[model samples]
Target: MVEALDLALGGVAVGILAWGFERYRTRFVKSDLIIAGALAVGLLIFVVLPGVYDSIGAALNIDGRFVLLSMLAQFVLLAIILHLLSMVRETNARFSDLVRNISADQAPQMDGGERTIFVVIPAYNEGKTITSVVKSLPDTIRGYTLQPVVVSDGSVDDTAENARYNGTVVVEHLVNQGQGGALKTGFQIALEQEADIVVTMDGDGQHPAEELERLVSPVIDDEADYVMGSRYKGENKTGNGVVRESGIRSFTWLINALTKSEITDCTNGFRAIRASGLEDMKLTEERFSAPELIIEARKNGLRIQEIPITIEERQAGETKKPQLMYAIGLTRAILATWIR
Candidate 1:
């Protein structure tokens, strides 16, 4: 017997079909028409075969068939959302690649040196400490000529100008793409200039310029392909208190477990990698890329080592990383890197 629901569904389906036909003929929107038709047909099917869903649900041992329909609808919506997100991510990647190329092209031509090392200091509005950081770097490390590439990642302050005035290589981004994006530009520059070792340090002055050699020593000496400067392994003068410290240790433990590598500090930005090692690694995270780099290096079979290094308090502006955002970003980086 035909029920009230069947009659209502039938009327709705017929109305949708007529409306879709009229809209398609007038507006000529294929997508709209297709969607309207599909939905109308689904409703019509439900109205014609009222007990079909229950029969199929019973066969499949589903407890609630109506709930199954709702879940399927939600799944479709999620799939569409995920597909859109993927497109946005791809677009971002393309834009970042363009910036990196432009930055590398505009970077000052390195002097005629047989071997070179690029110390990439990524800063955003770090004007106060930028100049001092550039001045403190050694002229050479283990005979490799030092090339300080200060990437002012869309800084609105005097960061780029200060570094440029101090006779350091400055790569300025027109838009902020986070530290990872700035470092990626530096890596591109390192590759183009044929650098032997690429050392990455923070521009906020947390990383000591004096310990640069110690950080790059393992990579320079061929002892390891990549090196990380660990505050836990050395002095943590952060003075930001225990919250940050505990978070780092916890994440480090989780990363070590996942990678099966005994890494003391996974969040440390002070790192050195062979130019060739960067070639094998694929890093994507714009903000939380620290773990992404380590994960990629490990995946590519690069021997990784962590050395003791001092991490001082920020010299100027407040920390960009808020606690909640930092935790979420770090977790995202870890899982995304490990799963891939």
Candidate 2:
């Protein structure tokens, strides 16, 4: 009777081993099928073979000390095996949940009807190209709704006045605070108006307005929290001019190298970001160095992606590259962020 009971208990361990093998077979196969196979063999060696040996020992009246020790060994082995099986199952389940949540959270939510997108063009003396850039964007990206805003960076020229006339909501900075400040103003206004997505493009018209779809698709499809247009991603490449282009490439290379990240066209100002992603970005710089924005996004654990975009020559305006102190200030800020 005692022998029969021991065999029944042994069957329970075998049953648990079988259940674990079948349940986690796919995961085990990923690591090594041989390890999984070894588990099966070990189960037979420790549980099934032991039960047979114990039955013969009990029939021959084996010593009481040996019998007790054998029972204890069986219990300990069963417990350890079961614990290891549970751990693998739990770990895999946890990893799957994290991936699903991250993927789901990044997707852009669609509106029931026409969703409003506010395009913010931060302009600083971009009078010549402002009009063309304003007129170039179509009514929609494929079929999403859109609205454009021209945030004048205290342009001394007629950029602010012209943007208002070209069917845009023009906001003016009393004093030039730089591109980052202009973007902050535009984003705040968009958020106030309940915009679904807010796009920031260069007022200098270097961004091809016709290809706005590429900038907005990831947001519409829910792939990323922010999407920056990459002139290096595809055949579509545009820039302010040769000198400006070289500067852009050099700065981009510097950033990519420091971050150990791939940023094909880092300096392209053509980007579309979710209103949520801009919720708390301070954007303190009043100059042209906006790499701080990317740094901020990374620090906040935002999921950022890039889309290939066509870079175009400035349609009708002068370039606004910072010459001396502004460059120095930007370098200082970037280094500080790295050290921090």
Candidate 3:
């Protein structure tokens, strides 16, 4: 009766495994399917040849099938561990490739004539909204020649093409190096072009192009070396959930307390800076660049100001950032920047 019950359970397990494979075949990659298939084959062998286990136990001088089963389990576990190690190695290889693509020769140059305003936009996989972001920029800001430079950070889509279509200069990375790396590249290009003022904004269409003048106003007047946009200070809209909203407020308070700066927004990416001031700023954080840049700027005693701005929902694809991970990274960046 015990043997019969074991066989029945094995049959049921095989049926369930087959059902799962059939139901989710499209969700798995070829390698995943191969692993599942190997497991299924092992299960089939165990179910169809129950007596074979006893034969193997006898050959190995074992008393019962339990020892054989344990050996098989160990083998399967080893296979899984080997697969995971391969995955990790592959991921490391891709990251190394990304780092290799970033050029070391970033020397600022001047165009034929002096240009006053340079807009640096760092984008990754923002094919849907990049065109509009580039097009919405004014031909000239407050009589200063406006030049939009789009840095495509290893985008697999048409982000570079769209920016170029809108008559903006576009630079592309072979692989993604995060937002900080992209912005650094953009800043170097802007400085090379001999821009007096450098403006950084999002490519996701959350930042309005109409506010360009206001964002750069303080820098133009020499009242501040850096102007940070503040959603909390002026008329603005926030589409973030309650948790995100709370996180932003908490981080802003912490940054303010540590930096001794009264800026209402610490993480807002919409901001402007004098090119000359940024010459001394050495940025290193790839993903958490916003906070690091702010902390570094504050430490260097560069004049900082805050102005009211608006942030809206992304116009295209879902946000690439995972909220919890982003907050954690930002927190670490803030602490690291403050200490260093």
Candidate 1 regions with alpha-carbon error over 4 angstroms: 1-71, 109-113
Compared with the true structure, the alpha-carbon lDDT of candidate 2 equals: 0.69
Whole-model lDDT per candidate: 0.86, 0.69, 0.81
Selected candidate, larger TM-score, 2 vs 3 = 3
- Lowest-sum lDDT 10-residue window in model 2: 99-108
lDDT of 2 by residue, 1-340 (tens): 7467546656765665666677577565432344444545544554446665556567777755347447656876796688679778677545533432332233234344568788988888988878877888787776667788887776899997777654577767666666766776677677766788888888877787777887888888889877888877755434355665666677667777777757777666888888887887645444544577776666666678988777776676555666566556667666655456
| Candidate numbers sorted by TM-score from highest down | 1, 3, 2
The candidate scoring highest on lDDT is 1
| Poorly placed runs, candidate 3 (over 4 Å) | 1-110
Candidate 3 to native Cα RMSD, angstroms: 11.5
Error of 1 at 178 (Å): 1.0
Candidate 1: pairs in clash: none
* TM-score top scorer: 1
Worst 10 residues of 3 by lDDT: 100-109
Model 3: residue 295 alpha-carbon error in angstroms: 1.0
lDDT for 96 (candidate 3): 40
Q: What lDDT would candidate 3 get against the real structure?
A: 0.81
